[model samples]
Target chain A: MLIIHTALHGEARALINHFSLKRQHDMNAFACFRADNIFLIESGIGKTNTASAIGWACGMLNVSSPVMLNIGMAGHTACSIGECYIANRIEDHATQHRYYPPQLVDTPLGSDCLLTLDRPTENYPEKCMVDMEASAFMQAAIRFTTIELCQSIKVISDNTLKPAGRMKDSEVESLLAPHTEAVTGLASDLGQYRAELMDNTGATFSQLTQQWHFTKYQQQQLARLLQRHQALQPDEELIDTIPAWIDSGKAFMRWLDGHLNNLPVRL
Target chain B: MFSTIYVEEAVCDHPRTRKILQHFRGRTVIECRHYGELLNLKAQNFRLQKKQPALILAEKQGKKILPAPAGYHIGARHNYYFSHMLNCIYDCRYCFLQGMYQSACSVLFVNYEDFIHHIRQQALSHHDEAVHFFSGYDGDSLALEPLSLFAETFINDLRNISNIWLELRTKSTQVRSLLALEPWPQCIVAFSFTPEDISKALEHGVPAIQQRLNAIDKLQQRGWPIGLRLDPLIDIEDFEQQYRGLLQQLFSVINIDNIHSISFGAFRMPENFYNRMTGLYPKERLFAFNMERHDGIVSYGESREQDMRNTMREMLLEYVRPSILFPCVA
Candidate 1:
């Protein structure tokens, strides 16, 4: 299940609409909602709050490696104030530490680091961006889950030089609203791909077993022949002739079959 | 599918013990006096075990965290690594664990807290340095995360320690645990990658390159730090394009500004381990590669190794900063 947490409810609501998630409930301290096996918790603001909310949610849910995504606006040090940059690395400046969250693409978005601190750093350098709660949320949420389950996504709302306080809450919500849709869409697509891959793996295994069949002793002998040949793919006719060659036990044919079978199979 | 459960007598009562044992039902329970008895076994057949690997559940007994290799740190000074489990789920023909142990059964050290305690001690000892502790060296970190909760437990402990760094190296795309946590600064959940062609051919039972990349993208979008490791680089025809294409695909969508580090290395294995691996899978094409034995290490001949390394280094220099590009060999 994909568990998304954000500071703003409107943006979360917008995401629910974009992704077609249902409004579940307002569980007192934090608002709770769900959509097609994916859940969202509006955990308010700050690292401590997000951490607490995530912990509470995890305690209430039974999942195998539940993904926690903290989606909100973040100030960028490299990009312009309005542009968006996906954080490939998240760093906790207060702790002088860093982490690599699971990225969504075969190629990562960018090779930049995002700094998470208790408070925004005033006059932050162009190389470092600032976020309020990723570290606390990571620390608390990781306790209830494994590394693959936790993640945070922040859109650029302001430059590090600019105070985040100056950006109105409405402005932050609006900035995240559209991006949330994109993020949700991407998540859905990824979920589908994961399912498809699992299905394909079964077919792959069956094909391998059928294509390569030999007894334990024969497999060992084939390995030697392949090693000597230094080739993975021998002619199919030659492969078919391997049994006959083995039966004959001629030194050269025996050696060839032995070498060919030991070679690693290339998909 | 014979049922087999090798338990460490110490953690026989842990709550998770019952749940773990449940996965291997109808199996015989073997109680070993110590981990050494199992780890030091030499005559086991890795290939035969691949048909059905047993399960080992024991309490982790000694130092859990240790210093990473010299000049191995991507950006941190105090690099430390920990292994809560030993052995892997996949049966890679080249794995060294096969040669190092007597059995091919996967070993799960149930005493996670003990490992955590040792981590605390190590972090305190290197309080002034950026100590990095790497998991998945002895096993695939996340492949069994659901069963062990290993990464989940250790990541939190490492998070509290300011001077320590944690890297969960894996090929598995089991990021459910990582996606749920807020991204940490001191931990790098790096993915070890091979070219799609190489992975599909040689890395059996591992997630595809595209899936791994998709997982990386998801984490990156959610504000996670990502590291790219192309270690033990295999030599292949059109090697330049294969690796370059891999790099291009990786750098294109990866948040380059947020990249923690990128590392690449030529394939090398201990001579003894290679000999054993060759014995197990004599038909493997990987063994047939033009490898040479040098100083007790088996690897591609020096000229080929140098060429592959130099090519990859040059290719990487184009995209990643010098600081983030850590070549495994000098």
Candidate 2:
């Protein structure tokens, strides 16, 4: 699942239209939209609202490890007005706590440092991208998933030449529209990576549990044995080879271990 | 090959840090208060970061020199180890670093003078006894030689210390720096090896067995003392034939007199480290073996461990004297 949190309606409009997301009427605490596996939350501006919305969404969705993204606008010192960048470092202005999100995927977008402030700042003193929610989004999202799955994408809307007060909603929508495909592409890549890591383990465990009455400890052993079977003989199936005489989970586990130990160590 | 470099504020202006940063001229250099702020973050995956690890330059504070592990010794009564760097370049599946560290980025403590000062202090305290100092405990000693210049600088500093012994334990074929300097009498260049099939299956990014043997042959010819470290003996189906063949190939190339010491140890891991390693690579067949836990350390039971150790000991005795063989058991 991919959860995207945007700070304004203009920032969320292009992604909502691109993914064909509909308003989720049941959610009352935050404005939410959803499609098949993608969710968008239009959180109000600032760090507190962004963190509150993320916590609510995590509780409502109940996902163990969902890929999360925060897409919005940011101000830079000298970057071009319409350029897009993914944040490699995020720092909270109030507390000065910093977070470095590891870049693992191959993407065409450039990366920059992001500074999350309590309010808007017109003076671009440092050579860093300025925002209002990336730091809190990362701090909240990593509690539910790994760092590689939590990321932030920002479209440059204001710079030193053109201050923040001059930017309008339509201009924000236009700036984010061109980078919707890139943002979705990154979320898709992370979701696929998570799926590949989770695909093979649970299916075999469910198959074996239905065939025998396993004690609590026996269930853990059964899961480990099934994992070893999948690692050593990936193409072969072990569920169909169980004999009818193995009545208890203990006896079944013993039978399974005998088979796994006999397989040749390929190295 | 790193795309990013993180520099601690303390060492950002150090001469060694500045010199090393020259090599990576155009890469992104992010400054942090300490290296642990990024490397010790929660939710960081070791397996994911290993693909594109960044380089962290920092100062080694606190205790720099300490006693080595109980069995990790050559022949000295007082043995200690220090790490000027952390995390190896190679990604061996059975390495304990994956379980011990949260991040896979390599950290190079650019303050080499501080580590040297600590080594000198420890050696002075144990002046009466033959003191041994070991490197590559947390990382490889020579794998990043060109970038760190660790071997060349340390060899020059400790050349004339008669009571101090230095051991560079590594599997890297990075021997150009060692070959350029005269061999130190008290230093031993230790090379680690497993069977070819096991190396192919487990040790990723390590040089081939023959290439490593060739590198050792060159060092031995230059009058450097060579140590054979056949550690963490992996359990395989054809254990006898595989290890016997490996020992035979090693003994054929180098002169017997140059063999400083030979050590063999069975595979073992602290129970918690084993659990974390299995969580990182659940599909790995190496962790799927039926292991027994005793005293919070997991190993292939006592009978299996003794069998492997005794067999390797017998095979090694065929090539070197018994006085030079050490069996490390923890």
- Chain A TM-score values, per prediction: 0.63, 0.91
| Model 2: how far residue A20 lies from native, Å | 2.8
**lDDT by residue for model 2 (B1-330), tens:** 677899999998999999999999977788888889887997877887787788899999999988999977889899999999899889989899998898988999998988988888898898768999999989999998988999889989987777889999999999999999999978899999999889999999999999999999999999899988999899888999999988888888978899899889999999988988887787899987677899999998889999999999999888888999989886
DockQ for all candidate structures vs. native: 0.07, 0.65
- Assign candidate 2 its CAPRI class: medium
The TM-score of candidate 1 is 0.56
Q: For model 2, how does the per-residue alpha-carbon lDDT over A2-42 read when each residue is reduced to its tens digit? A: 99999998889898889999999998888899998888998
Q: Which candidate comes out best when scored by lDDT?
A: 2
Per-residue lDDT of candidate 1, residues A117-210 (tens digit): 7766556655655677776677666565433335566777776456566656566667776566456654554454333222212342343235
Model 2 TM-score (2 dp): 0.96
Q: Once superposed on the true structure, which residue ranges of model 2 sit more than 4 Å away at CA?
A: A166-169, A210-219
